[model samples]
Target chain A: MTFPMGLAGPISGLVCGVLFGYVLQRGGLGNGCRLTAQLRLQDWTVFNVMFTAILVSAGGLYVLELAGVMHAADIFIPTTFLWATLLGGVLIGVGMAIGGYCPGTSVVGAAAGRIDGIVFFAGLIIGVVAFAGIYTPITPLLGAAAGPQAQTLGDLLGLPAWAVLAILTGVAAGVWWFTRRSAASPAITCAD
Target chain B: MMKQRPIWNSHAAGAVLGLVLLLTFVLTGHGLGASGAPTAIAAAAANVVAPAATQANDYLGWMVEGGRNPLNSWITWEVIGVALGALAAAWWSGHLRVRLEGPPRANNSGRLALALAGGILSGFGARVSAGCTSGLGLSGSATLATAGFVFLIGFFGAGVLTGLLTRRMWK
Candidate 1:
């Protein structure tokens, strides 16, 4: 069910975006040291934060979906671009490792007055332009694998969505334990 | 207030973010996103320079589907709020200032160059995959999409690999 794009859309987006940004910054995602540590595998702050968010959203979405308040079908779901999505994920990960700013974090970083974040955002725009320019040539390769691939794990396994989400919650708990055990003695700081 | 206040616990922040995602979905029927706004801007720019080409191009044509103004999108408004919200948080926490983030051995130019390169790759990847962390990780994963899990795996793998390779950038 496609909703009409109107004032409410942008207004709600603004409210959510603001809250997202505030939490991200207050959560230390906007901290260069913490972000770098996350990539370095020394500090698991990012891991903890990101996975927890995923779990929360997953659980929330499932509840909403089941309650008939908002169905998953109504959300903006991504089509399974098998190769493109995976490859893009790798590239994004590598880029984050290199630049130390995730997509949303880059905006927060810039807002927090990090010059590097600003520069990275500029590069991101340029990259988008380039992608658009060469989109036609790459469409065939990226859009390959025309078989069924975008189904959810729950669908494929014939399990309820809530069950799959419960497993994820367990996984998150495991990660928390692991991160707790892996905490560095001094809590790694940014070195100049 | 030019001092650092201890941050909220990471898990706590994550939960908050998740609540926000739920709120957004409740209000708009979609999850949060960060890169789509940039994509919209790029498409809008292309439309201005070459109206026909933008409409004809498969990648950019969606921006104008149903005669929609890509610039007037939720992602744009959300991203704008992201910046403002971050600024507000920073100010409240007394962490709002410019301090170069390169290691002692690395200079400003080197760090900036890396930022540019990394940003470009990330942007391009987001476009290619059709979602960023917010779009793919939070929203897609929340929806339990297989592509979302695949993207998450690939993302972590590359991050670990590049982190090993680019240790000098931060440490």
Candidate 2:
């Protein structure tokens, strides 16, 4: 069910965003070194934190939907375009490795007084403008390689939400265990 | 000054983060985001400089149409909260400092320049993908959206590759 924002939308959003930012900062995401470490495979902090968060949210979301508190249909799920998303992800990864920050991190990092973060935010503005300028040319490419409309993993696989959640939970646990093991073995990991 | 506090346990902090995300969805009918703010800021800025032209642009026009204020967007308010909350966190943790962050091999100037370039690429890519790590990777993944997983694979796949190639700069 879509929550009626009315006049409270922005205020509620601000409150939620504040808590979100606080949690991220406390989670060690405000530092560029910690974030970039994920790229170097020297630290699994990002992977651990992110995976845990994903699982928690997924469990809560789908479970609630199952319990009839939330409706999956009302949630905003961006239309899938395989090729565009893949290419976009590649670009973002390259940028993340180079900048040590993504869009969200850059904003929080800047607030924490990181100059590089501020610069990245400025760069983001410039990039958005650039994309706007070239919007027409990029339109076709972005729209190409579209996927099935309004489908989720559970829907596509013909599995119930609970089953999908269980499977993903298992996968996440395995990945987490592997990462922890890799971290424990100093022989394969780079010096942080 | 109080000494800097050690960061929280990764899993504990992440659990809290997840709860926050869930609250966001429950309250707002959408997930947390970061890229939309910059897009709106850009649109608002363009409106000031080239009102008609900016409003006529294909991508950004919707943001400024009908004398609409892009700054009034939900993401804009949320981002403002993010900045404020981050500042408070930094102060509370005694980690508030103004400095450049990078490996020793990269100088301040080079790092800043790379950050700018990286931001450009990320910002551009987020638009193309219709979201960033938070928007697409986290929120979309929670929804079990296929695009989210694909984006994550491509993102991390290329990220690991780039990090290896740029190891000297970082390590």
DockQ values per model: 0.64, 0.69
lDDT scores for all predictions? 0.80, 0.83
Clashing pairs in 1: A192-B104
> What are the runs in model 2 whose C-alpha is more than 4 Å off?
A1-8, A181-192
Candidate 2 clashing pairs, residues 3+ apart or interchain: none
- Taking the tens digit of each residue's C-alpha lDDT, what string does model 1 give over B1-171? 756687787788889988887777677767788998778878888888888988988788987877789988788999999999999999888888886664445789988888888889999999988898889877788778777787888888888888877676554
lDDT (10s digit) by residue, model 2, range A25-97:
8788877777777788877778888888888988888778777877877777766798888988898898889
lDDT of 1 by residue, A75-129 (tens): 7666677788889999899888878786888999989889988888888888898
Q: How does candidate 2 score on lDDT? A: 0.83
Docking quality band of candidate 1, CAPRI definitions: medium
Docking verdict class for candidate 2: medium
